[model samples]
Target: MNKIVDLTLNYTNDFTGFSKETSRTIKKDGWNASILTFYSHCGTHMDAPIHFNVSQQTIDKIPVSDFVGKAWVIDVREVGSKGLITVNHIPNDVLNDFVSGDSLVFWTGWSQYVNIPKYRDELPRISKDLANWCVDNKVKMIGVEPPSVADVNNIEEVTKIHQILLKSVVIIEGLTNLEKLQSNCVELIALPLKIEGGDGSPARVIAIEKQ
Candidate 1:
């Protein structure tokens, strides 16, 4: 039997305090509810090229083919808090398993800290070399459990990483529940909301294990 793991964070009005509620009624009748909120990149999300570069592709402009592919989950949990994942963290055997156009998921165990201050302010990041390697190897997409690949406080590094990866590979960030999959390889399907001209959009990411 195969397994499916949802790699998305739960969005709530008070979770991150980033959501807004219009109404909640349960007195004598049923309920018609709505929410007013603003989140460009909150949950499991995909960053389009426009996120870091002007005149670049927007969320809706990205090819749907970029959202689905064979994924290789590289475990780097051994590198402790605030660690940086570099080319060296990736094993040669694992690199050998990747072919051009494969999706790469970094399992940094950081997803455990979603919605926390430290997770947003001090998450692990991918090194420039690793970012370059993803491009050179023709990776279709790169997924990380952290809020951003680079430190959220460091705009320069963050912009550079986004620019590098967004130019070629789709950048999937703020992913959760990857640790539940318990598999090295899986088919990843990440579909972002079709927000017109948006820099990024929340996504529903899933991992499908093969028999």
Candidate 2:
């Protein structure tokens, strides 16, 4: 049996960068469909290097294989509001086993405040040191529960971290329900819309719990 946990923030008409219009309904059109308007980088999304001008590669240009991988979660629940996350936060055992191509996830408890301003304005963030560490370690992808891996309000911090990490690895953000994952490691699948020339796109991210 495989246990799959959704690691994406639920979206709704009220959420930021998302709007839904009833285009068709069972009662009106004998079917059900809606027009969804979404911002490419909103909600649970994957960032392409081009998002930060790190490269010309768009989300669609990223290899599909890069979206699937064995991902290890580093529990950073104690990383309080606006806390700084460094490589030291990762457990030694996990770090010892971590290798090139293995994705990394920071399981911060920030998702609980998704509906509030703090979720974006005062979220915990990954430090520049950690970003560089990921690059040096050749991490394939890095996931974070916050809407962003760095302080979104700080353009310098956000741009620097995104550039440092995106240049070397793909990024998954705005994740939720990571606490539901029962294992330290899981098979991660995060598929983004294949928009041509897209800087980034919202992704449906899930984790197949280790069995």
Candidate 3:
């Protein structure tokens, strides 16, 4: 049997406490509820094309078939802080194994900094060349354990990377717990919330190891 690993982050309020709460008392019983305050990009999330382009497809309009598929996890842990993950970081043998429609998951070892400001502001990023490679190679989706594929502080680089990949590929961000998965190839499933017209939505990402 294959082992399943969850790669989603836990959602919480305001990075601290609940944003809103309500309670109702009926007879001798009571009910309580709370509204969550989270960024759509928070936790493990899917980036719809509309996230970068207004005229592009919204989250709900995204094809459900794109959410699950064979995936490759490339490890670039040796890359330094704020380093660029270029084509070279991907092993030649790994590139040879890529199929036109396979999803690519990058393990930059950045998930270790989640909840820290540095995780968003100072982290390794995918370079333009790598983005172009994915486009030219016909990658179905790109998943990363970091919050984004580009430097969070560099808007221009971020925009360019998003524009390039978002044009034809789904982007999965904020993945967690990928270090637990030992295989380089696995079945990936990133299911986003069915929010109509949403630019992007949080998702529950998982990997199924092959026996």
Candidate 4:
């Protein structure tokens, strides 16, 4: 039998620019209702090219097929904080498993800091070399257990990395629970909310392990 693993972080009020406020109390309205206010890029989200450039593609323009595919989770937990996650981090055997259109997610074990201040601080970021490798290998999409693929402190590099991958591969960031998945290879489905002309959207990511 196969099992499904939810790879998303639950959206909460504490997250930056996120709020679920009561619009009507159950006792007063006889029903439960709330108003949600959040940045489109809040929580576990997928970024579009438009995020880096206003004229570039938006999340709504990306094909649904790009959000789901055969995936491999490359474990790079050993790469410490603010470390560059280079191609060397992946073993040769694991590196050879990549194929065109394959979705790849890195398991850096950073999800544990979700509720901590360090969560948004320095994080293991993908190196330019690895980003180039993904492009050369024709990868379809990439996901990470960090807020962004590039160092958030370096706006220039962040934009560069996003531009590189956005040219071909979709980028999924702020992913959590990647450790709960037992299989290296699984079907990845990370669908983001469709916001017209929006740069990105929070997403619900999941993995389906094959039997």
Candidate 5:
């Protein structure tokens, strides 16, 4: 048996990086629909190398198979707001078992602040050392509950961290519900919208835990 968990935030009128307006109604237009506008980097989104000028790759250019992989969720909830997480924070067992092409997810417990201002402004970020480790180890992707892997407020820090990781690994941010997963490792499938020449796009992410 296996359990599935949705790791994406519910997009709504109040959700960041998204705006929705009713365009049709069932009673009037005989159908229901809305006009959706999404921010490329907002709300459970995936980033392509072009996002940081690291490369010319776009969200649509990514192979669909690259979006799915085995992910090891590292519990990093102890890192507080605006905390810089280094490679040392990752347990030795995870480092020993984590192999090339496997993704790494950080369970920072920051999604609880999704509705407030703190979620983006005071997010925990990955340090440069950790970013180098991801690239050095050939991690396929890095997922975090925060909107960005680096400090969003710092121009230099954010740019440097993103460039390092974007050079080799895909990035998935604004993930939620990691606490519900019972296993440390799971199959993660994160599919992003195929927007032509787009640097990023909102993604629907999920984790399958084997029972």
Candidate 6:
């Protein structure tokens, strides 16, 4: 048996700061479909290197294998709101447990603040040093339970961290319901829309736990 956990945030008008209107619906037009107006980076999404580097690979150019991998969750929720997440927050055992090419997801418990101002203002951020650590360790990707992996309040620092991580790893942001995962290790599948030359795209991220 396999238990699938959805690690995606439900999209709402408030989610992407976009006004969504329906020109067609099952009740009105005999089908359920609506035009969506939202940023590619909005909601649970994967950031490609092109998001930071114009000359880098786009969302479509990234290989499909990168979207699927063995992932482990690290519980860092002990860090409070607006806390700084350094390598010290992670123990040596947890750091050493990771093998190269593994997807590391941070369970920061910040998804509860989704759609709120605190989601961006009070969200905890991964430090530059920690981002560099991931690079040095050859981590394939990093996911977080916040709107961003970096401090949204500090644009420069956010850019720096993104640059550091995007150099070698895929950055997955805005994940929710990570606390529902019962296994430390799971199969992570986060496939983004293959938009040509897209910087980023909202992704449907899920974790599969085998029983």
Give RMSD to native, each candidate.
1.8, 1.0, 2.3, 1.4, 0.8, 1.6
What clash pairs does model 1 have? none
Query: For model 1, how does the per-residue alpha-carbon lDDT over 71-186 read when each residue is reduced to its tens digit?
Result: 99988888756778998887788787879999889998887887678788878998888999999999998999998888878888888888888769999998888778877899
Give candidate 3's whole-model lDDT: 0.85
- Which stretches of model 5 miss by more than 4 angstroms? none
Best by TM-score: 5
Candidate 3 lDDT over 1-211, as tens digits, reads: 9999999887765343224444444544565555566567777788888888935699999889999899988988888589888888777888888889998998888888877888888888888999999989988989988888898688898999999999788999988887899999999999999999888888988999988
Candidate 6 Cα outliers beyond 4 Å, as residue runs: 26-29
Question: Can you give the lDDT of residue 1 in candidate 2?
Answer: 89
- Candidate 3 weakest lDDT stretch, 10 residues: 14-23
Judged by whole-model lDDT over C-alpha atoms, candidate 2 comes out at 0.91
* Cα lDDT listed for each candidate: 0.85, 0.91, 0.85, 0.87, 0.93, 0.87
After best superposition, candidate 3 residue 83: deviation in angstroms? 0.8
Count: clashes, candidate 6: 0
In model 4, state the lDDT of residue 113.
87
Candidate 1 is scored at a TM of 0.93
Q: List the lowest-lDDT window of 10 residues for candidate 1.
A: 21-30
Give me candidate 5's TM-score against the actual structure: 0.98
Ranking by lDDT: 5, 2, 4, 6, 1, 3
Clash-forming residue pairs, model 6:
none
Deviation in angstroms for 35 in model 3? Answer: 1.8
- What TM-score does model 6 achieve against the real structure? 0.93
Instruction: Please give the distance, in angstroms, between residue 157's alpha carbon in candidate 6 and its true position after superposition.
Output: 0.2
- Stronger candidate by lDDT (2 vs 3): 2
Greater lDDT among 3 and 4 belongs to 4
Better of 2 and 4 by TM-score: 2
- In model 2, the runs with Cα more than 4 Å from the true position are none
